[model samples]
Target: MSAFGKDGVTGLYETHLPVARLERAIDFYENRLGLERAYTNDERRVAFFWVGGKQSGMLGLWETGTAPLGMRLHFAFHASEEWLLDGCSRLRDAGISPLGFHGEAVEEPVVIGWVPAMMLYFKDPDGHSLEALHVLPQPPDRAFGIRSLTAWRQYAS
Candidate 1:
């Protein structure tokens, strides 16, 4: 018998990001990332964007003070490889830097060796770290170890 039980928890419902300004954040998510502006409230200083769907894939941006220096929050969206690549190209074409794990300009997608997920990362106008990842469809190996992006490249060398 499996140890796992039905916890009524299956997948992500929604996520929120704090920003210093609402309108700029809304523009970034909408114009920059092409997310649909589902809702907005200037009084509440909040904007909600539909990432993929109206119900589940919702991302909210709320106006708040900036985080303390060196403090950052990170989140990721599950994307197909094609979608991620297209997004990278789009952002880069708009003169935005496509970032990887180190938050630097990405020459290529960073491959997470453990989960074997291919991912790309970037920052919002508020400096919020965001990522797009594609988890490879493959079973895990029993003998496993984690490797950094640079280190993982050694295997292919």
Candidate 2:
């Protein structure tokens, strides 16, 4: 009964964030995170990076100078369990702290029971919360709540 049919939406294609410095943001996303740069506009003070692939998803960074109060936004990128698990060390090597769901420094990804997904959180150069997430191969258990992977395994057993 929808005009767009039953297909609905597939996934996020693009996301934009405001940054205080374009070059610094570019270094964090492109050099540190390993995202491929798709395009950049020096005049418009914006840049775009390919997330997974050229056709998969894109992230746009706009240099808006430093805001007085600063508005922070959060977004997640689809990742494999292996990447999420190993990202803690990789992030630390890059001088970034891998964080848990509660915003605490962590050594491993945390499980969001409602979504039943493992996620690793960190901040970009501009303080925008970024996450690498991978859905678990299990049924959702809302009562389980958010916990570390170790706790989740123990609870499941």
The lDDT leader among the candidates is 2
lDDT of 1 by residue, 61-141 (tens): 888856664335788988887876576687787556788777777766777666777788888888889888887654543
What is the Cα-based lDDT of residue 141 in candidate 1? 32
What is the C-alpha local distance difference test score of each model?
0.74, 0.91
Badly placed stretches (over 4 Å) of model 2 are 2-6, 65-69
Report residue 19 deviation for candidate 1 (angstroms).
0.4
- Model 2, poorest ten-residue lDDT window? 1-10
21-134, model 2: which lDDT tens digit per residue?
Answer: 999999999989989999999999999999999889999999986558677899999999888879899889888899998799999889988889999999998889999999
The per-residue C-alpha lDDT of model 1 at residue 68 equals 63
Q: What is the lDDT of residue 63 in candidate 1?
A: 88
Q: Model 2, 48: alpha-carbon shift in Å? A: 0.3
- The C-alpha local distance difference test score for the whole of candidate 1 amounts to 0.74
